[model samples]
Target: MSKKERKLSAAEQRRKEKFLEKCSTMETEGYRMENLSFSVLQINLLSVFIALPVNFLFMFSYFLFNDFSLRSVYLPYAPLLFLLIFLLLIVVHEAIHGITWGYFAPDGRKSIEYGVIWQALTPYCTCSSPLTKKQYFWGALMPTIILGFLPGIIAIITGWEPLFFVSQFMILAGAGDFLIVARLLLHRPKNAQVIYLDHPYECGLVAFLKNID
Candidate 1:
């Protein structure tokens, strides 16, 4: 009721309005509202069905050429390597997303954030600020298709079993690709479904969601 309190409230409203406007503009340029209806299971199954056998054959051919054992090479520091590989794969996956989108975004700024969805009990990376759907899709899959698979090929040529590790990482990235493809196929709204971030306070929505629950 006081004048100072009213002034503060007005300032907060203005800030929120500005942020919302920015979000709206970005959405208009990059995404269209859609009804996404695919379940995580469906996407996972599809990805497995397609990627597994292909990856297996690729791995087999790789080892046939170079004679590297994933199990053997992974022994000395399996635990440490798993941790390292997992973290590195995540960075590589997200970096590819950023790079691809950054190449196309109007401002060429791609922001990324990591967090846990306690409800789902998983951590995910959010990629933001793709200028359009094409940029979004390309950025989303670049990691899996490029960094993930190419290294495995290189590893096969060099007889490095670690390439299997990288290939597996690519499969993990493929899982993300599956989800994105399914979501898009099912028609998910951009504001509600797209995962990339484009601003300084990109995690603001996540914080907002957490506070509400």
Candidate 2:
């Protein structure tokens, strides 16, 4: 087989090995391993399960009780309003990740740094915290969960679709967080390590993970 095909075959073998190991570990620990892989459908179902109802209730209450709507302000500028709201949601989501990880981190002094790649095409925020795998997963998830429900509530209360869109975007971000969570849950390395991601541009995320005693 070609080198590329060999590499693909090796990766598939490793995946199967990991899955079997995970199953054995879960069985020994009295846990089910079925959902550990966390398929796309499973993630979507989980997101809808946790986010949809909250959004509905939030929007309902806000619109019923408050007078904030496109009708109240500049209806002609709804598109601009939606864009602004979406950006705001992104900021809030990232901020939530920082705050949660920082507070619960071992040192309780995490740092957040921003960087761009390819002359500013790909940009990301790096949050460095001295947290265990479980802690990291929870910290990453807090923002997604909070934004998912909170913005939806605000949207309903204010009768604004922008808020709903914010919640939807939050859910998309949450999908990434959920994937990380799924990996950590399934893997749960014995060493209880921290993780790092290396992008095309280093962006100075050098000390992303620190060994905590």
- Judged by TM-score, which candidate is best? 1
What Cα-based lDDT does every candidate model obtain?
Answer: 0.53, 0.51
lDDT tens digits by residue: candidate 1, 27-141: 5666432323223344445657656765787778785887654574548878787778777767667667666766776666434444443333334444444334456567666
Model 2, residue 85: C-alpha shift (Å):
1.8
TM-score for all models, in order of appearance: 0.59, 0.49
Candidate 2 TM-score versus the reference: 0.49
Q: Model 1 Cα displacement at 48 (Å)?
A: 3.3
lDDT tens digits, residue span 25-49, model 2: 5457554322223333344456455
Q: List the candidate 1 regions with Cα displacement exceeding 4 Å.
A: 1-32, 37-46, 71-74, 110-114, 127-130, 182-213
